[model samples]
Target: MGRSGLPPGEDIIILLVEDNQGDVRLLEEAFHDASIANTLYIVNDGDEALDFVKQRNEYADVARPDLILLDWKLPTLSGEEVLKEIKSNSSLEQIPVIVLTGSEAQTDIITSYNNQANAYVPKPVDPDEFIDVIRTLENFWLSVVRFPTHTDED
Candidate 1:
């Protein structure tokens, strides 16, 4: 068993779909001191993010994410489009997706929820607050809630 206590290859897995370098760096730094075992996979744009989640092309060997943290604004396909795609697909729909972005627009919030986002978190401007939020999110989503570790056999 690993540090998270499931199995050898099963550590808490997270996929972050973000384009901002600073935001990405901050998120990485926040997870550096995490208590549980985890692996964070990053995809800078929506297209690449979709490819990674679908396990297509270069992402064929990548582990499926237990949770996906997605930024609302992304290049190529927008986060809204990605969320719609993920939710519509049967194989991908079960993965909990949280919309983590700086935008707090009422429309964006409403749209995210309408499209079936598991949660929507507004990014704090202060780095310390951001880290604190990440830690709190990690504690709740990773430790408290149980995600499906095994994919159903096709």
Candidate 2:
């Protein structure tokens, strides 16, 4: 069980769909600092993230994530596309998705919320602010929110 008391057998899994290596490193450091116990599964592109979530082909053994952090811009399929797919699927729609992007545009924010994103966060330019934002995210989602565990067979 995690510090959040999320059942004894279930694991807290986070799926991060981002392409930037620097951002990935920063997120890793921030999670460490926050002392959140969870498994982070990373994929560079949106298409691969979708495949992992669906447990397709090479990702047959992939575990269902408790939450997803999606980036706006990606190499193959865009983050919006991935979000749409997840929200449209009955089995996956219940999982919370936090749209973490560098985009601060109004249209992007509106679109993200329209697509059933649980929260939208604008990426901070400053490293310290970025870490703080990550910490806040951990505090809210991990410590406060209650997420469902995956039990049904895919």
Candidate 3:
């Protein structure tokens, strides 16, 4: 079995809602070496993130993600707003959504939890540290937890 607890060939799907291109690349590199098997789908803006999760427009045929990593700073709609929408939706609420942002603001952390975020993680400044953080997140979220399974056909 893979680290996520699914049978050997199955892969966990993760949605990353981040606008920063540099952070996205770092995440890609980190996931490339992660111990668990995962398919990371990225949305560069908040609007696209919502659309992707809600399966709107171009995202209509995509598989629903088992986990989500959200960033606070984004273009168009903000992360708080996106988090609210996802949590309010019955179909999407079961998927774990973690707020992964650079801000260590008490307000941001509180707001994320208020909007029903499953967890909150601060971004590390150093590139190597950032990768290590991602690996740690993957280890706990992917290896330790048994992810939700969607019964609906994709």
Which one is best on TM-score?
A: 3
Per-model TM-score versus the true fold: 0.93, 0.93, 0.94
**Lowest lDDT 10-mer window, candidate 3?**
1-10
C-alpha-based local distance difference test score of model 3: 0.89
**Which digits, one per residue and each the tens of the lDDT, describe model 2 over residues 1-154?**
4445578655578899999999999998887666657888889998899998898978888888888999998999998999999999998898899999999999999999999999999999999999999999999998888886567664
Q: Largest lDDT belongs to which candidate? A: 1
Worst 10 residues of 1 by lDDT: 1-10
TM-score of 3: 0.94
Better of 1 and 2 by lDDT: 1
What's model 1's lDDT at 92?
Answer: 90
- Which digits, one per residue and each the tens of the lDDT, describe model 1 over residues 21-138? 9999999987778877788999999999999989999998898888999999999999999999999998899889999999999999999999999999999999999999999999
Cα lDDT tens digits for candidate 3, 1-154: 4556566778899999998999999999988888777899999888999889988999998888989999998899999999999999988888899999999999999999998999999999999999989989988898899875567742
Instruction: Sum up the clashes in candidate 1.
Output: 0
lDDT of each: 0.90, 0.88, 0.89
Q: Runs in model 3 with CA error above 4 Å? A: 1-8
* TM-score-better candidate, 2 vs 3: 3
